[model samples]
Target: MKAPPPNILFFLTDNQRNDLLGCAGNPIIKTPNIDRLAASGVRFENAFCTSPICAASRASYLTGTSEKRHRFTFLTSPLQSAYTDISYPATLKMAGYRTGLIGKFGIATNGIVPSLQDEDAVEKMFDVFDNYEHWTEEGYEIRQPDGSVRHLTDITGDKTINFLRTHQSDHPGQPFCLSVSFNAPHAQDNDPRCYIWPATEDHLYAETQIPEPFNAHPDFFRQLPKFLRETESRVRWQKRYATSEDYQRNMRGLYRMVSGVDRNIGRILGTMDQLSLSNNTVIIFASDHGMYYGDRGLSDCWQLNEQSIRIPLIILDPRADENNRGLIREELALNIDIAPTILELANLNVSDKMQGKSLVPLLEKKKVDWRKAFFCEHRFHRADIPKSEGVRTQRWKYIRYYEQQPVYEELYDLRNDPHESFNLAGDHRFSNHLKRLRRRCDKMSAECA
Candidate 1:
């Protein structure tokens, strides 16, 4: 009998920063389970999202295409069925894999309030789809089958475990793909407390002193362009980080939410081990996009800053040779690459329409000519957020706000100014360098379009 393919477990978190994990060198945040996953898998040291917003990045991850190609951005836009049909989950399902999706699927929220009615089309992509949107009041108010309300993270973990157990019983010889998306660490915009987590996690970082980033200072906020200084970012900063107490409260709440999610992940990992599925299951951990914890006086993740664009990517393929296990790669990885990687892992061919290249070569430690740079873009979300695009190379980053009058630009030598503190776009000393990057950015933007 031919052996079935390996099972896939993908965990996607919301509004998580790259530096949140203990393995990522943060001394404070507790992420033992994720750190364990990293210890047993390959961690990409510099993974970034193609788009910094929730819907666009999630779409990119599904279709393995850029935002320009997917044509889904903004809060009220629904991802086209055409794209969803070709999405990784849909493709995997077509290829005879039992696919399940749990937790928050951000791409289906097209109206003022996320409705299950609107998700009827996208729900067909998965075999066992639980399309829950915790961002909405109705979605968050849902109770478990036991008649007890729980945190969204706990509910998601329970659903994931149930799905795994059911799949094991119904299809012991068949492979399955399960996607668990958790809406954690993302601030509750409608809640009075802003950030919400389990009550048990209230003391996770209570006594710890959370240091503010350098850009959170008023002077740094003043240094921004007039448009940025007046954008919704500044308003959110005022609400979350204007005062020391507010900063600490919000930061601690955010960390607590993350810790809560991590605990649920630990439970999932334990279940996998108990079921003896750990060895044959390929595990992936990542976020939709990075978040800004009061960086640049910004409280959200619309900007092209490093804190907003960079995300954590860890992949554990049990089939990998010993030499590649627990290896850390410095090459750039993007959210769009996720689909191709999963398809490659299933021993399937990648679609030509996918702009992302598979990371299988890197996981296998094979010699390949990788990309030199990648382009990222942000379309207008609100009146406060301007449309912008940029190209990031290993040593430099160039951002241009095309919608703004006079065309604002930012050029940062990432090697020298990793925090993006200095914008050398207007400096005559680097005129040639800036000009080259601008042309490169323009060319890449055109190609992506």
Candidate 2:
């Protein structure tokens, strides 16, 4: 008989920017474990999320499709049954792989939607599902069955370790796909203290000085459209970044939360090694979407800026050739590609309905034609955060706020202006280039829609 497929371990974090990792060039944030994982695996330098919001991007990652196809872009929207039937976890479970999910299952968890809260309806997709939502200031405690209360991150790590140990012991010969999602680094929206980390990590970045991003300059906020300047992003920015002391304290808290997550990752990796499962497992690490920590005078991630769209992507396939390991690919990878890549690694055929292409060729360092550009979108009922769409390529980015009273547009030449400090939409010198990109953007919007 043929050998069973490799076990899959996916680690997902919340509201983490692509640049936060030490391997990604942030000297301040010490993500040594994540850096080591990137060193042992293939890292994609330009991975992006199809949508910048939590629910939408998570849906895309599971279904291998865009928000337009899944129709879960808004807050409290539930994942449709039609797509859940073919989601990565559901399909893998159907194919005889024991599937498990832990931590923030953001999609469809909003209690406002009754159908989404149907336990029996959602639990059928995975063999072991432990769902937890955002932790508030008063509710961050998880009282264990043994009467021990622990930090949410520690509880999450304990549950994950238990799942791994149980999976190995109960089903030694069966392949398993486990997804561990962490809620750290994403601040508690309703709390005044905002970002929270474990007590042990309080001293992680005590002596570090955090530098302000280009977008944090007052001039950047002055240049934004009135609608955007008044959005919730700006509101949160005022709350968290109004003073230098506030900025330093909040930024350090955010980094501390990230380091706490990194420590948990170290524990998980150590457990895998102890179980002798490191060689036969494929580990992938990524974030649901990027976050803006005072970037563009914004504190959240709804805009079409690079800080919101780009995410860190690392894949470690134990079966990879020696030469292929420890390599970095500059290809454009999207969150939608995750499901397809997982299925490909499992030696299963990708569904025709899934729009994302497999990344196996890129992982193998084989020659293949890849996408030149990808589309991003954000839709919301609130008027402050206007519904928007854009197309981003290697050299150019074109965005359109279609819902604004007078349609707002932005054009950036990424090669020359990586920080997007200057907008060239009205410049006569780039009119022809702008026209071509506008046409491409419109075409892609319709195609993706």
Question: lDDT of each structure?
Answer: 0.85, 0.85
Could you tell me how far off, in angstroms, the CA of residue 401 lies in candidate 2 after the best superposition? Answer: 0.4
Candidate 2, after superposition: displacement of residue 423 in Å? 1.0
Which candidate achieves the best TM-score against the true structure?
A: 2
lDDT of 1: 0.85
Query: Could you give candidate 1's per-residue lDDT for residues 262-289 as a string of tens digits?
Result: 9999999899888889989999999999
Task: List pairs with backbone clashes in candidate 2.
Answer: none
Residue 315 alpha-carbon offset, candidate 2, angstroms = 0.4
Q: Considering summed lDDT, which 10 consecutive residues are worst modelled in model 2?
A: 109-118
Candidate 1, clashing residue pairs?
none
- Candidate 1's C-alpha runs over 4 A off are 1-3, 75-77, 109-124, 138-148
